[model samples]
Target: MYLNQHEIKSLLNKSFDNFVDFVNTLPDIRFTASPYGKWSAGQQLDHLTKSIRPISSALGFPKVTLRYFGISQRPSRSFDQLVTDYQRVLNGGFKTTRAYMPGVIYPSQRPALLQNFLLQKNKLTVKLLGWSEKDLDKYRLPHPLLGKITVREMLYYIAHHNEHHLAKLKDQELQGYTWQNQLQQLIF
Candidate 1:
């Protein structure tokens, strides 16, 4: 479904807040625990924060600057189309680069990570507010995974992204139960 800027803003605010609360609720050990050698909860948050920096910078840029960067003049895709496009990229095996991965931050640094997350998230929200919905629909912003997209699409991702990560974290939370559950399934 499509979300206007206001709807997107609300969802983004709620999702990020909820995600942070979820992280805070985790046991100390869960911060660093890699359920299956995949990203730990902390690493996932770190990656998301890093991923947002470029978008924040882009949001700060003037339209002229975007022009210099050769912002796409392609037709603005609908919000759902933008999300579907990103999903396709993931299904196509688009992995985040190593530089974007978490390092030297985990259980011991949870506070720092959470603080940074708030800082970056705040910047993104403010920058987004600077644009009109039409402006958001008109200008193209480069996304690390989604390539060039209208600002509206960017916000769409911003709105939905944390929920995606939150689901992953929940799966990780349940990771230790898998083996026991499997045994029960077999016994049944």
Candidate 2:
């Protein structure tokens, strides 16, 4: 529920580490293969890197500048609540915005993508540690899908978001399952 910076950091590290380990082990062909025209593992990694870069950059800004977004009026949501909200949105057919989408990621880019993701993740961890627990709950950041959420909630979302993509990548059954097929099945 209430995760202090250290706890949040640990969760973030574990999720990211697990996701990276799984992805790194995939063969070049597997990494580049876009199952059913969806994102390939490399594309997912690229998307993740794109998603995290901004959070780390934003956190480095002075607290005064962050106030431009204002503070949270209510308490931060628990991790489960945030995940549930995210899942509900996903189920409702929420698609990622253009800025967060990944381009065609080549297998050759895996190492660089991993390196960049680690850099962004580490910066985020450091920035998070720089804040007090109270400040974490007090400050707000605008998330495209979740709207304005507290810093803590954002961390929770990051952790779960990494796991979410990891699960998708790991699902062998997803290889041939396309959204269009799912929709066609529903139509008939």
Provide C-alpha RMSD values for all models, in order.
4.6, 5.4
- Using all chains and alpha carbons, the TM-scores for the candidates as numbered come to 0.86, 0.91
Q: Which lDDT value does model 2 have at 78?
A: 86
State the lDDT of candidate 2 residue by residue for 1-188, as single tens digits. 77888999999999989989998788776687776677888988899988988888988999989898898799988888999999998999989999999998887899999999888889988888789999888999899988989989999999999999999988843543567545644553
Best-fitting candidate, scored by lDDT: 2
User: Per-residue lDDT tens digits of candidate 1, residues 18-53?
Assistant: 889999998766776666667778888898888777
Worst 10 residues of 1 by lDDT: 179-188
lDDT of 2: 0.86
Model 1 segments beyond 4 Å from truth?
71-75, 178-188
lDDT of 2 at 40: 84
Q: Pick the candidate with the highest TM-score.
A: 2
Clashes of 1: 0
